[model samples]
Target: MRFALLGVAVLAVSLFVMSGQMGVPSDLPFPVQVAIAGAAGVAAWHARRSWWPLAALGAVTYAWLVVWPPLLVASYFAGRTLGRGRGLAAYLGACLAVQGVSALVGEARDGPQEIMTASLGNALFMALGTIGLPLAVGLWTRARKETAEERARRLEREQIMRAEQVRAQERARIAREMHDIVAHRVSLIVLHAGALEVRTTDEETAETAALIGGIGREALSNLRDVLGVLRTPRPDSPAPDLSPHPALDDPDLSPRPALGDPDATYRPQPTLGDLDRLLDQSRALGITVTRHDEGDPRPVEETVERTAYRVIQEALTNVHKHAGDAHTDVLLRFADGELEVEIRNQRPHGHPENLLGTDLSGAGWGLVGLRERVELLGGTLRTSTEESGGFLVSARIPA
Candidate 1:
């Protein structure tokens, strides 16, 4: 579009120069004037795309004749687009070349006295309107454009900085919440599960209880890893090349392997297949757990599986923390492109108590984290206390 405008301007200015000359110009022949005008049009096209071409074309055309409007326009654009020193040199050189050629041509046509007077008058007019004015305007336009671009870039940089600051603050907030609240609840669950291991004499129960305790400890470790990522200062070096959002088919969702431990292995994440193990762990703790699955139980997305497991983990942990000895029922329903998990427990027989001596006063951040995890996967989580007397936790997630 801009080049088209330049083409139109070049044509219009060239025709105007030709018409304005009429019969008054005689230093150059009519054929040479027409040829120079054609060259000026070509120069205009090249000038818009680059300064070097304009500089070269301006030097050629302006040195030959005085009635070339395209050369003046091209010189102005070269000045605007090129570096300050280079642009100024090109503009001045073209102007000087024009005056030098006019003087030589005029001297050859008439006597030096007659030619000098006419050339001086022509040079003065050209200097003010053609050469000096265009250079000044181009320089002014260049300065204005550069100033506007700088301002726009500064605003963009500021916006990106502000966004990064906000993200850092949010990460810090999540870290604090996990430390103050989530860590406490998980610790209690681990402590209680460990207590069950010692208290139970039944071999099967002890082994199952030990497994649950080990799982809880592992969870605590992973939780700490996540916390480290949130709290640690950003690395000075570039982050590892990894996808921001891994494909659903991707087995690993972590952006990169944990730093400083090539020997350290990533633990397998829990999914629906691990649901039985989770229920068995709770059962070993002397809680009555009933699980039922409806619809053909098939494989689902990792995120959906992970979130569903987390929902159950949180629900069962709450059962241990706040509703000891309660009869808990877990329901899994797989429907068209969705999976739903519902956990409901009957009223506790008495005061809340865990296998551990801890008072079981939950720190309350588990549900907060659970909700965040679920919503992040484009799922909805709902929890409520039944009027009949118990708590219910539910999650509906994409499959």
Candidate 2:
């Protein structure tokens, strides 16, 4: 709006000056000239974004300054350029309109060629009038439009980035929720299993105690697998694999104590402590359970200690569930700074029984939790059925 006012004021001063040099009557009726000037002023005032007003005011301004030939030509070109393309076309039509009016008003005053020949200045104005001002102004307007468009694009990109940041934060929050739920419930199960094992001595109760130990070890393994995503690098490892433990399930909240758990007096969690007993329990279910050791059972960290216990626990549990009345081999290997535990059992020819009465639904989560636990302690776990019809789970944990 300010710029429109400025352009109009500039045009007015130029016209008044040119009017004098062209020798138009100073005594010309103030009323007629004022009326023309008022129209130009109004057009300029309304030219906020509409090209019509700019074209209209510019056309009229040129028509009134007839004698000072340059002003007439400048006005025509300026109007056309002010609104290029369709606007320019519209401006040309308006110019022709103003020309028609001047022709009518001065029909008796002078002839057309005579009007052109009257001034040498008009000829010079025509050459520049053809292209100069219009082209320059058009490019200026195009550049201004481009700048505005770039600014809008930048704002849109910023909005998308902010939205993505919010979504990532939400995903991390959900991941945290899942971890807490599994950890809390599985820990409670281990607690009870440890307590019951301590107080039970009857044969049936002893079997139940062995099963509880197996389940607790399964839970610990599952917890490790789930937590594998957060595996931190140890100085001796390039890629840490928390091998032994796997996955977890929530039900009946059984208890199995942790390695060094104060509730169980930090007793060694079922590691080598129950290898013979684990075989006895599996064999009692009529599954042929065998054992193997590759190297000496030497000193190892609690992380390795607990993971080893969990691996054997889940393997035997799987045999109990899916390979009842089948041959099972439990192999332990201590090599380098790592301990490897492998459990392989033949797939039964018939439908397998529970062998023990724990929920099968709860059994599925075992491997996943085991992997998490193993990875967290710089270990790796692999499980699949072998070509000979046995399911095999193998884990190696750093000591």
The numbered model that scores best in lDDT is 1
For residues 119-186, could you state the per-residue lDDT of candidate 2 as single tens digits?
44543343235334554555576667779899999989999988877765664455456556765566
By summed lDDT, the worst window of 10 consecutive residues in model 2 runs over 232-241
Question: What's the lDDT for residue 385 in model 2?
Answer: 65
Candidate-wise lDDT, in order: 0.70, 0.60
Q: At residue 170, what lDDT does model 1 achieve?
A: 93
Query: What is the alpha-carbon lDDT for the whole of candidate 2?
Result: 0.60
List candidate 1 segments past 4 Å from native: 1-72, 83-129, 136-144, 147-216, 233-260, 263-269, 293-300, 321-329, 344-372, 382-394
Q: Report lDDT (Cα) of residue 184, candidate 1.
A: 64
lDDT of candidate 2 at residue 307, scale 0 to 100: 82
Model 1 per-residue lDDT tens digits across residues 1-399: 676677567655655554444212434566765666666666666665665665565555444444456656765775577677765676577567666776666565565323432477865766566667787788899899999999999999999999999998898889778766766676677777778889999989888777777766766667655666676545443332221222211222123345686423334578888899999888878899999899988889887898899899989988888778889999999988889999998888874433323344554678889989988888888988786577888998988
